[model samples]
Target chain A: MLRKLTVLAAAVGLAFVATSALAASTKEEPVAPSAPWSFDGPFGTYDQAQLQRGYKVYREVCSSCHSMNLLAFRNLGDKGGPFWDPKYKSSVENGYVKAIAKDYQIADIDRDTGDAIKRPGTPADHFVAPFANEAAARASNGGALPPDMSLLARAREGGPDYIYSIVTGYHPAPAGLTVPAGKFYNPYMQGDLSSFWKGDPNKVPVGGFIAMPPPLADGKVSFDDKSPSDLKAEARDVSAFLMWAADPKMEERKQTGLAVMIFLLVFSGILYASYRTLWRNIDHH
Target chain B: MTAHTTYEPKTAIERWLDTRLPIVRLGAEVLEFPTPKNLNYWWTFGGILSFCLATQIVTGIVLAMHYQAGGASAFLSVEQGIMRDVNYGWLIRGIHANGASMFFIAVYIHMFRGMYYGSYKAPRELLWLLGCVIYLLMMATAFMGYVLPWGQMSFWGAKVITNLLGAFPIIGKPITTLLWGGFAVDDPTLNRFFSLHYLLPFLIAAVVALHIWALHVPGNNNPTGVEVKSKADTVPFHPYYTVKDGFAIGVFLILFAVFIFYEPDALGHADNFIAANPLVTPAHIVPEWYFLPFYAILRAIPDKLSGVIAMFGAIAMLFALPWLNTSKVKSMRYRPTSKVYFLVFVVVCLILGWCGAQLPDDAVIPALGKTGINLIDSDLNSYVWLSRIATAYYFAYFLLITPILGLRETPLPVPDSISKPVLAGEAAKKD
Candidate 1:
């Protein structure tokens, strides 16, 4: 009798849960269309060429607004990265990453004066910020702060998909909508509360108006390795690059994970055998 | 020195050590302690939880070696320094992060098993109470650890939870300020949370030791809810339970590894990846998944003070469970009605978790085919009403239904001896 009552009560509770879930699902937000990623599934590894192209796209366009502060110049030449080469070192004498690092000027402290100074970047130096400070960044971009790109791929909801959509999703304002002077309409940018002027619904983008003017265009960036320079290709490349930036050790991690799994499988099998042997003579209730 | 059967030293050196400390004898006795022969797979959770704690502590200590506790550097230290710079840092951090969820998973199963078997009944009441203490400590430790990442959700979650102290009438504001270490959650707050997060786990370890000691005093409770009457009804803890627990641990570790390796962030909110900014708050500020049921209870009430009280009450009610349950019967399996009520309560808890995930006051009924109806404004979108109902039932299940059912319900006939089932099973095996 109690079992029946419990089942009935459970059924009622489950009904409410289902109902609430259904209601919540009705308030739909646009989701990024899935794109094929090289580093998606269990056996997936990063595409060396794709990562290289993505880095190129990031260097030419995205670097102007974004700061990859957490990424060191040495990481670019590390294993699993697009530019990774076992023989390559970030020394000025060595290879391309070293050359790339030297191209930027990083801020350093003056040893004698104990004051900030700028010098050519080194292998250990993090990517230099385009702006001196947040104030400078906002001043240059009409008060909109471009977030650091180091972990951007992991930070957002849809991640690489979201980044790809926003880069290519920019379009003219809708027929009835009037975009404000500083803002540009992008269907993919999910605006925070301050994204638009307060109480001005017409000025708000369908999703959220972003301050960034469309940053990508066909053939805007020239790739030396001869990958496609179309807007979509460029977008894909940059998104892939950001994903690598977010999780550079993914390839190594997955490989180690496989080994761990195999060890656990064999170890557990042995343990189970031992357990059965121990229990063979004893009858459990 | 102990009641349980123990090893006798056969050599002069062994006898010398045994007389001095007797630690080896203590280990032998514990391993040989008689356990109920009727224990099922549910009994394996205790071993799994212990393994989880050890895993967390090991990985956590290594991660802390690279972790920076200050607000400014904490986020970057985790995402960049530990994950990127350290050798196999990602693996260590992933294991630690996912290990927390796994720990909760094992502990929840252990708790539910205890509940189902009426493990809290007298003589074992102190054991159950000690388990509760460990549980509360786990919650506090997990909460502080979550804040250590200093991500968007971490910052806001800390802010929201600490601010709840202000709901107290006279001492609330002062307590909140002291907890925050200033006007709001800042550097000092982060520093203290890290210090306390590090300290509480050791405290939990101590309490866990007591919990085990308390359990040994009375021995483990079994599914039959009957006391061991004869030697035939019990088996040595070693060889029987130790081997079984080892196999279970291996299986549990595989499951834990899947999360660590494959879906490391599947259990976490994405917003947590973003560094915390005082100026910006995420659209929704939610706690870790384990806290959702209590979080739901907190939000169920409209008033701040009442909501806080209700959430604490939910946990406090668990401590009162042993005394509140007046039934002569211990196991719900014997009392069919009690079993039904238990199932309902589990479902109710799950619903509360679901409610916690949703925006409060959101409509439960979908607005499909409704023309020009203002549903968000109406009570439809809100789960406020439903949550209140569920919360009321939660209290009623323990306070009213448990006592009433204990007095009125008749239980199924229990076996007189554990050996009967074993003997019957052996006879069947011959066929």
Candidate 2:
């Protein structure tokens, strides 16, 4: 009985060591990117006009489905303006949207009838949704839940570039390509086994495709002649605007990080010197 | 001691370091202990475990700087930190997350080393108990830390564990509600858990100090079961053990760096990437890998209270181990038969961990279908049977086998003298 127990113990130990060794030996494979089409470029530095165009696209098309719940309406006129151009701040004050205050009261309008007065738009007022609830919204758009765009630029894998590409990538179907049913296909999206395909080769970029059909038609939004004035250019402009919306303080953070790094470098030198001075006499007999 | 009798001019820096870092002398004394000559690589795990603990504390502090504990802002704050906050904030968070896994890896090895060398026996029982306490505290700390991120896994994981309290016959729902700080896990629960997670590491550190103190009292138990009989039996710990432990720490740090730099998120759950959504439930829910063994024990019981008791009992049982074993023998080296039982116990533990990771239904089919026997109708019931059997074996190794084997088993011949020369002479004469 003792011998049997001893053997059993040894076998268990051997098994554990062997299994651990096996686990150690099998190297894990690298994870592939979940989204295939990515925008590759430096994140910072975008043209001012492009941002203006993006705001227009967002206001007209994207705003119907997405809500930037965290943003206050009045913030549009801030230094980095989405509602007003910095160069033409005066034009913003006289624009169609203006702040107004009113009191609720019924007064005689023509001696025979009295009516409650109506109020104008205010900076404090939030953008009203087209649908009352999620069910109503879904009923209008084939049951697909539209994600909030407040942080969409940051949440996605490729930040602004992915958004830009997805917007401009939409086109009619090309020759020799068959798209399946129920699934809207994007040629650029790797690992997408979806069958729905739409896009013409002339309209779409070689590696670009998106489920969202072309949102910007040619000459839809006018920009300065030097700026990207086409639909594709407008798509890129709006993507940049969304990126800024997602992280308004990004530039400030980067600047602060640089300053802190410099301070740490100087501080660490002093600390190292002090540490050496403190330890200098420790070896004495 | 007299070698430094002659006064010599000291460098200014050396004097300054000595004044500020006074603990260096005590550290030197610890490093210089006269360890048994037979000490090997396994003994290095204790030092490596300490290193991991220190790493965790530093990284955890950095992560806490940007982390918001309130449910309203917690998930958003983490995302902001990853996307736009401090530079390399994502890397820092990932390192801390993976560091918890690595710390467990080291402690498990350290604990196993103690068991294998019979370091928990006799005078060192308190040390072993201290270690077990540290392990328990570590589990609680890690569990709470996971919830602080407020991701999908974080929310669901917290809900599932807290709900386990509801399994109790009378006080279950009330207890769970109290734990959650409301009807469900929300801002209040997250806040309290964050506070506790921050506090527990220090508690663990204190226990670890006690563990080391206990260890020093009895010294380390080496591979050989024989006690030190003469001056030749051990070497002074200073230069000898210090260099060995230092070298081992360096090697261990290299491995730690590989994980930290190259594959920081390898150990983390993918579901944690998505923000917490109360409306959407993940298809599969599982605890972190480190908790798998106890999770298996929890699943074993059919009754809610019994399962809770059994899970807690599994850990509590370890405390009574020193007293429970009937075996007189301290080390497996001297007990040929008992060693086999010890190995079998280790396998059972690994099997339980693997089973815990599997879905309950998948685990049940094999047990019933393969054997063509229905010992229990529910998979959980079978798990309970398996755990009970394993738990029985675990205690039996200590309570029954050790004392019994010590008295009955004929041990291999042991050398009488510590010196190799003496043993050599004896061998020559026999030839």
Highest DockQ among the candidates is held by which one?
1
What is each predicted model's overall lDDT from 0 to 1?
Answer: 0.82, 0.62
Best-matching candidate per lDDT: 1
Candidate 2 docking band:
incorrect
Candidate of highest TM-score: 1
Quote the lDDT for A205 in model 1. 40
Candidate 1 local lDDT, B80-149, one digit each (tens)? 8899989999999999988887788778778877888899998799999999999999999999999999
The 10 consecutive residues of candidate 2 chain B with the worst lDDT sum are B1-10
* Candidate 2 ranges beyond 4 A from true positions: A1-285, B1-28, B82-84, B169-174, B363-374, B379-408, B415-431
* DockQ of predicted candidate 1: 0.38
Regions of model 1 farther than 4 Å from truth:
A1-28, A89-94, A110-116, A192-206, B367-381, B421-431
